[model samples]
Target: MNTQLMPSVSVEDITRAHLRLKGIVLDSPLQYSHRLSEIYGANIYLKREDLQEVRSYKIRGAYNNMSLLSDAQRAQGVVCASAGNHSQGMALACAKMGVRGTIFMPSVTPQQKVKKAKAFGKEFVEVVLVGDTYDDAYAEAIKAAETNGWTFVHPFDDLNTIAGQGTVGLEIYSAANFPIHKVVMAIGGGGLSAGVGSFFKALSPETEIIGVEPKGAPSMYESLRAGKIVNLEKIDSFVDGAAVRQVGKINFPIVQEVVKEVILVPEGQVCATMLDLYNEDGIVAEPAGCLSVAALAKLGDIRGQNIVCVIGGGNNDIARTSEIQERALLWAGLKHYFIVEFPQRAGALRDFLHVLGPDDDITHFEYTKKHNRAVGPALVGIQLSDPATYDDTMKRMAESGFKTRAINKDSTLFEMFI
Candidate 1:
């Protein structure tokens, strides 16, 4: 709890980092979001770091850290661990800086991310697939660096990386034409939040800095509440980029000092935000990228104030779209999965179909045991035109002598059947 134990990162450092990043990383746009503004009742601006060179703001930190490496360090090479974004940034930094680099990624990392990191580094970086979690891969990367005498480029812990990530705040301040009331961003290892929060606190003292985390992986939020760093035993990796088990040691203190509030949003809400951005504004954002905007719904009123939401990355895999839509629909209450026990008679399905309202539609149906003679359970997924109709339809189905068990509330069974 002693702030004196940790070295402070000044606004000067972030300013210098911003200067260092010029012509190297993209000075991403701070554009007004009409759709979001209308939905949230605020003058909403999106800091589009998703459009950065590596499709993330990570390159700013990775490049800054690599650029500052000593000649001997550069010659010795660099190593890092990441699930996706950071690896791509490091690989591209190494390629551009002409330094050899090795990246350790989780074995479960998406194939698209692995391929992009490889393509970015070309011959300069080597990708090593390691254990199942980012923390597992991080430990392996640290060991690899120690064994090879390579300079390890931490994803978020180092002061230089935090300062580099802080450049985002600098750009946001410089680009915003109106007075900014609040800034919102997603937190993983806390590097981006630490950096941006520090810079904004020093420069725009009145602006509130809000940090958001996925509810399933609320390391920073819980840590701040506990007055110390807290490591989670399990995390939901759906928001892979921000699903960190623990916040960075070096960055946590900065977050505690500068960030005013930390909010947690459900993964389903993040998915819904991603879908909205893509469908409404033609913006493609990964789950973590949607976290900032997703928190807007939780904020009560911002009618006259100006708010900035940092869209952190856009490295989403096309293959995850169906799952994302599924989660979004579930969050919106438009979709429900049920296990229905049907009688052995010929009119069983017909009776069940009659229970559905005119707007109710079956999206999925499968007999769990069609060969069973007496009675069999059917896995049925239904979509409602209006979410409000769900309760009424369920009540009608129950009254009609149909036996049904809702699996949507049971995550284990929901995942298994739906």
Candidate 2:
């Protein structure tokens, strides 16, 4: 392993980038959240970067890096790989600078995002969907950039990109009238966290900077723990924006130095937070956007403290709403899946149904296989009106003489049948 120290990014770089982005990027608002404050017993402020032109902070870094490109570099054009947000950012930046851009996105990129990126870039940008993951697309993009002699606009890692992203922290501190004790941000390739963490450490030295990652994809956390960049063999892309195999080499040191702590939140918790943001605040947050907010649940007591949660993006696919709701319910213990084998006798289902509490509702029922005068397995998905009824409901099922296996507890069974 190389123990060499890379060049460090400074507040001067961030301030200079902020000046460059003055009229180009919107100065997104920082608003206080009454509901969140009440729930957490803290003065909660949300930095609404989701409301930016590209509906994410990605534009800041993308445009800043491209704008600084020399005339020859711009003429040769630029190429990048992104799952969604960065692609849109680059497309919009290309249009703004009148530069031709090529974006390589994973085939798994949501339709909503692909369309948005193309729409933003219009004639200035070309979108190519290749590979199943962002890493795959990234490799292809690098090859194309090298072969074509085009500037490869890294989504993160580059000093210019990090400096551009640091402007978010500048905005947070500039617009904040009251003192901010802490600022929480979601970590992907560590661009946002590194940028924001560096800014706070430089300007607001007393303020704590915290980074959060999806529990399924804790690349940053794991990397910091191992004292090097660790590539994850697998990750849950449910939170696509933050699901990175490894943190950027350039950004890792900044994160380790400035970030006080890194926390991992379960994907289900992120889903539930997204739902809460939508229902209570009329805010539609993508899974990654909800990372900072979800960390509030893990913080035991933050009463009377002033904290800022950066909501990163709102590029959520409408098609994922149902899946999000299901995950939220499961996380809340309001939904459960069971494989129940019933005796080969008449009224067996009726008997099983009778055991279910009145508050329990049958959401899904399907027979996995047909049986002739023998016990057969049936899949049952039950939704509880109140989560507290889960224990009693399970007790009733156990006493009903039916062989019931809770699929939620058994990962193998759940993955196979559910």
Residue-level lDDT tens digits of model 2 in 187-264: 999998888888888888899998999999999999999988999999887888988888898999888888988999
Q: Residues 270-341, candidate 1, lDDT per residue (tens digit)? A: 999999899999899999998999999777788988999999999999999999998999989999989988
Q: TM-scores for all candidates?
A: 0.97, 0.96
Error of model 2, residue 75, in angstroms: 1.3
Let me know the TM-score candidate 2 reaches against the reference structure. 0.96
Flag regions of model 2 displaced more than 4 Å: 1-4, 368-373
Cα displacement (angstroms), candidate 2, residue 284, comes to 0.9
